[model samples]
Target: IQALPVSKTLQLDLLLGTTQRFVRTEPVRPLFKQLLEQVGAGLGEGQGLDAMAARLAAVEREQFQPFEDRHPFVWKNLLLNEFAYAMFPKGGAADIERELMGIVVKFALIKLYACGLMAHRGADFSLDDVVRVTYVLSRAITHNRRFLPNLLQTLQDHDALRLDVMTQFVL
Candidate 1:
């Protein structure tokens, strides 16, 4: 474990790429295609949305969900997880608030991008139409989930990184 250095990013791309590439002898082409298909399906169905604007209407609802069943971290803690704590520094309630904010923020951005892509794909509804339906009921944006992202950005602009600010969890 000592040989591994902490990373600023969630390291999603690098970490996933490594597994999808050299680690497997089958090559990267198939995995890439699968990834694209997964994204396409989500956009097409107006479902399976991720870190984006049109999601998490019931943030607190999802929080209490079972991890195996759905979003389990809602209203829960992130820091108690050894893996995440190792990646992010440390904090208390404020840190958890920041983490939740980040989750909401990411979901909003992803929803925007997905809606755009889905609209461009010649789906029946216009992008605006889609947004109207999606965003109207969205609890995240209504609650100003953007503040979380803005806070993170503010901290980043100061040339300092918070212990729990780098896409890691808080407890």
Candidate 2:
């Protein structure tokens, strides 16, 4: 977040991704430390920007988990919720969990891009193919642009969100 010349915009964008779409997972201790470092470096001279970029990039890095890909209703709930809030994929929403939802949506996008499970496209899922739920399919179909970027940006601006999630992951 500190990487941008506009520290405030970076912070706001980070907030939007977190409060609205981010999922409540993982401890924020390490994430917060990273954010602090980036912001701190940003406070300095030229080195600050580079440090901030690295820090922001670090904040935005993707954390991989083997998505079992169940929870169709949760996925559907996400779609229904996202659309209700006008964040139809790329439409955008301003709800808590938006960040997390975006993450889930991206996972589905990667799956689709790789031509993984095609059931959403009339193919069947393997018993252990990390099945994406119907809701995810809906988001994938309805909000491709927004959903995908939200996912990528989470990795891209992870430090910002990490700053928030840190409170939840109290030591």
- Candidate number of the best lDDT: 2
Q: Who wins the TM-score comparison?
A: 1
Segments of candidate 1 deviating more than 4 angstroms: 1-90, 124-151, 154-171
Candidate 1 lDDT over 50-123, as tens digits, reads 33213222221232123213433422332233225334335566686555444443343333333333433433
What C-alpha lDDT values do all the predictions have? 0.35, 0.36
* TM-score, one value per model: 0.25, 0.20
Error of 1 at 156 (Å): 10
TM-score of 2: 0.20
